[model samples]
Target: MSENIIQIEHLNKSFGDVKAVSDLSIRVKEGELYAFLGVNGAGKSTTISIICGQLSKDSGKVIVSGRNIDDGMQDVTRALGVVFQNSALDMALNVRENLETRAALYGIKGEAFRKRLEELAEILDFKDILSRTVGKLSGGQRRRIDIARALLHKPRILILDEPTTGLDPQTRRLLWDVTEKLRRSEKMTVFLTTHYMEEAADADYVVILDSGKISAEGTPLELKNKYTGDFITLYGVTKQELDKIGLPMETVRDGVRIAVPNTAAATELIVRYPELFKDYEITKGKMDDVFLAVTGKKLVGGNEK
Candidate 1:
C-alpha cells in the first residue's frame, strides 16, 4: 500500500471571531505533486503552516510521514522541506555559504555537506554563481537557491507556497519547467499552494479552497470538465455593438465577456450570422472559467471578501 506522506483531518484555526481553516481535510500521497488553489486569505497558507508546525492548530490533527505533527514536531519537521512565498535567503551571504549554513543547521557538515552541495548544484544546474552573493542574483536564481537550500537536508516532502508569484511570464514558465524537471528527477512528494491558474493546471491534483473550505478536489482536467461548460470570450467594437448581438454572456473586465455553449455555438453563430461581433475567442473550459463557475468569483481576486 502507498503511504500518505502528509495528512490533515478536520483541521481548524481561528483568530477571535474569524475562522481561518474550518473542517479541512487533505491527504497527499507519497511522490505526488498536489497543488492548492485559492485566493488570498482563503486559509491555504494557514493550513500549510499548521502542517509545518509554524502555527498551532485550534482543533483536529496533522500527521507527517507517519508521525503526528504536534506530538512529534521534531521528527515531522525534520522530514519536511519548505519553500515559502517570500525568499528566505540571506542577502549578505554568498549563495554557497548560505546553503552551507543551512546544511549545518540540519546537522550535515564536512564531506557529507560538500557532496550534498555538489549534488544539488548539479541537479539544479546552478554552477556559474555559487560564489556570488545572493543579493546580486536575479529573482529566479534566488528562488532556485532557496529550493536548493531546502533540499540540503534531503527531506521526504517539499512544500512550496506560491513559488511563481511576482515573476514575469518568461520567468514563470522557466520556473515551472524547472519544477517539472525536479519532480521527475527527485521523485519526492510536493505540496504547492498558488494563485496562478496555469500553475494549478499543471499539477497532478489540485485542491481548491474557497472561504476556508475545500471547494473542489481533482486533477486539473477533471475539475475543468466537471465544473466548466463551453465558454466564448467576446470583444466588440463598442459596448452597444456587443449589446446589439444580444447573446447571453457573462461580463468580464474592460470589453471582455464569456458566452456559453462554447465551440459548437460559436461556430453556429459565425456560420449563420457572420456579423455579430468583429472579434471573439472560444474554448471548451479553462481554469479561470471553472473558478468562476464553482465559486461565483473572479480569478483576479476581485469580488472576494
Candidate 2:
C-alpha cells in the first residue's frame, strides 16, 4: 500500500462564531489524484489553508509529506506546490521573466532553471508564448503559467484549488492532459478542489464536504452506486406507450426517462420492448446526480453554492 502523503487528525477551525472546519480528518495517498469537493462556504478553502500553514488551526494536526506543520513551516512549504483559483503571475512580466523570478526564490537558477523551464514549456505547450506578457495571455495560457511557476521547485505534492474556473472546454481538457502527464512523470500527488463534477469524476478518491463536515467519501463508482441510479431515455414514445410497458418513467424534454437499477435491467427493458426502444439512450449514473443526491443542491455553471 502507498503511504499517506497528507494526513489531518481531528482538525478544527473557526472564524469568530462561524465554524469553518469541524473535526475533519482525511488521508491522501502518495501519487494518487485525491479530490476534495464541496459547495461554497463548506470549509474546503479553510481546510486547505490550514494544511498549507497559511492559517493556524484552532485544534488538531496537519501533516504534509509526513512532516507535521507544527514542526517547521519551511520544511512543509518545500514539499508543496499550490496553484490558487486566482492568477499569481506578475502581469507586467513576460512568461519567462515571471518564471525566472519565481525560480530565483527557490534558488533554482543557472542551468537547472533553464532545463526545468524547457521541460515545463513542452509539457504545458507554452513554448510559443514564452515572450508574451502575462497580462496579454488568455485565461488558459495564464493558468498553465501559474501551474508551471508552482512546479518549478519540483514539490512532491501539488495542490490545485479550483485550477480551472473560467476556461473553455478545450482549454480545460488541455490543462487536465498536462496535469495527468505531470502526475505520471513525476510521481506527484495531486490534491484538487473543484466545483466541476465531471472533473472530480476522474479522481481516484473523492471526499464530499457539506457544512464544514464530511457528507460522503468514496470512489466515483462507489458513490454513484450508493446515491444514484441508471437512467434510460426513450425518444419517439409517448406517455401511453410508456404506461403500456408498465415501467415507472417521467417525461423529459426530448423523451421519457426511466430509472433502472443496473445495466442488466436497462438491457432487459430494451430487449423486452424492441419497438418502443427504437430510439433510446442508456446512461449510467453520473457524478452530477451523485452530487445532487448527496448534497441536496444542484451545481449551476460549475460555480453553484
Candidate 3:
C-alpha cells in the first residue's frame, strides 16, 4: 500500500466570528492525484493556505512528508510545489528571464539552471515560448510557465489551485496530459482543487467540503454509487410501452429516461426488451449529481459566501 504523503488531523481555522475551517481531516497518498473539492467560501482556499504555511491553523496537526509543519517550515516548503489560482509571473519579463529569477532563488545557477530549464521546457512543451513576454502569451501558455516555475525545485508534492479555471477545453486537456506525465515520470503526488466537476471526476480520490467541514470523501465511482442513481434513456419508445414494461420512467426531450438502481438493472431492462431499447443511451451518475446530493449548492458559478 502507498504511504500517506500529507496528513491533517482535526484542523480548525477561524476569522473573527466566522469559522473558515472546522475540524477537517484528510489523507493524501504518495503518487496519487487527490482532488479537494468545494464551492467558493467553503474553506477550500483557507485550508490550502494553511497547508502551504501562508496562514496558520487555529488548532491541528499538519504533517508533510513525515515532518511536522510547526517544527520547521523550510523542509515543508521544499517538499511542496504550488501553483496558485492566479498567475504569478512578471508580465514584462520573458519566460526565460522569469524562470531564471525563480531558479536563482533556489540557488540553481549556471549549468544546473540551464539543464533544469531545458528539462522543464521539454516536459511542459514550452521551449518555443521561452523568449516570449509572459503578458503577450495566451492563457494556456502562461499557465504552463507558472507550473514550470513552481516545479523548478523538483518538489515531491504539487499543489494546483484551480489551474484550469478559464482556459479553453483543448488547453485544459493539454495541461492534464502534462500533469499525468509528470506524475508518472517524477513520482510526485498531486493535490488539486478545482470547481470543474469533470476534472474532479478524474481524481484517484475526492473529498468534498461544505460549510468548512468534510461532507463526502471517496473515489468517483464510490460517491456516485452512494449518492446518485444510474440513468438509461430510450428513444423511439412510447410512454405506454414503458408503462407496460412496469418500470419507472420520465419523459425527456428526445426520449424517455428510466432510473435504475444499478448498471445491472439497466442492462437487464435492455436485455429483456432489446427492440424497445434499440436507440438508447445509458449514463451513470455524474460528479455534479454527487456534489449536489452532498451539498445544497451547485459546483460551478457563484460568488463565494
Candidate 4:
C-alpha cells in the first residue's frame, strides 16, 4: 500500500457567499488512520460529500483508487464505504432486514450474502439485536449495525464523518476498538473527521482544518512538539526543594509539574538543583496545546464547550 489511495488537488467549494473549502489539497496513504480535525462548519462534511459524490466541488480534482469521480464512478465507489454522522438505518426495520436491503443494493446475493452477514455479525457482535427493530436499539448498537452495513460489501477505504459524535465515553471506546480491529483485519484505510482531540490523537496522521482550509498537518506527537512547549513532571519535588530551583511549578501528587519553553530551560533547572529534582521527566505538549497555539482559540472554538 505504498501508493496514495485518495488524492485531492486545488479543491474549491462554496455555498453562495461562504467559501467552504479553498484551494484545499490532501493525500491519504492506503490503510492508515487519517483524521480530519475541525469544528462545526469547518468543511469536513462538505469534503466528505464531494468524495462520496453527494455534492460537487466548484473546481479541482479528486481521485480515489486512481479513478476520478467525474469519470464514471464505478471503480471509485466500489473502493469506498462511508458512514455518515446521522443514523442511516431504517428505524422501523430489524437489523437483519436493513443489512439484507443494503446487501441487495450492492448486488451481493444468495449464499455469499448470507455468509457475509454471518461474518459481520460475529465481528460486530450484533446477533442478539438482529431480529429487533433498529429503533429499539441503543445509539451504540445502532452505530455498530451501521458500521456492519457499510462493510458488508468490503470497501477498501472507510470514511467515518464524525461517527462517534454523540456517543458516551464507553460507547465511543467500544466503537473505536471495533474500528481499529476492522482496519487491521481488513487492511482498510480509515478516514475520519472529528472535533474530539482525544480521538484524533490516535490517528496515524492528522490534518486540522479551520474555516475550511488546512491549518496544520502532522503526526499527533509532531504537531504537539512543533506548536507547544515542553513540560516536565517531577517526583518528590517539594516546596523547600522548589525554592532552590527558583522555577515556578505546580504541585501535584507529592510532586510538581512545570511547563518549560525548551529543553534548555528544563536541563538548566535539573542541573542547577540535582538534589531538589528527585526524579524528573520531560513530556511533549498535548494535542489541545497544539490546537490552542495554532488556532489561537480553544479546541472547541474558543468557548468552554
TM-score of 3: 0.93
Clashing pairs in 1: none
In what order do the candidates fall by TM-score, top score first?
3, 4, 2, 1
Q: What's the distance in Å from true for residue 159, model 1?
A: 0.6
TM-score of each: 0.81, 0.91, 0.93, 0.92
User: What lDDT would candidate 2 get against the real structure?
Assistant: 0.89
Poorest 10 consecutive residues of model 3 by lDDT?
A: 296-305
Global lDDT scores for all candidate models: 0.81, 0.89, 0.90, 0.86
Looking at model 1, residue 204 earns an lDDT score of 83
**lDDT by residue for model 1 (63-116), tens:** 899999777688987888899988888999999899999999889999999999
Clashes of each: 0, 0, 0, 0
Q: Which ten residues in a row have the lowest lDDT in candidate 2?
A: 296-305
Of candidates 3 and 1, the better by TM-score: 3
Candidate 3 wrongly placed segments (more than 4 Å): 245-248, 251-254, 271-275, 302-305
Top TM-score prediction, candidate number: 3
Model 2: per-residue lDDT, tens digit, 165-232? 89878778887887787789888999999888988899999999877898899999899888988899
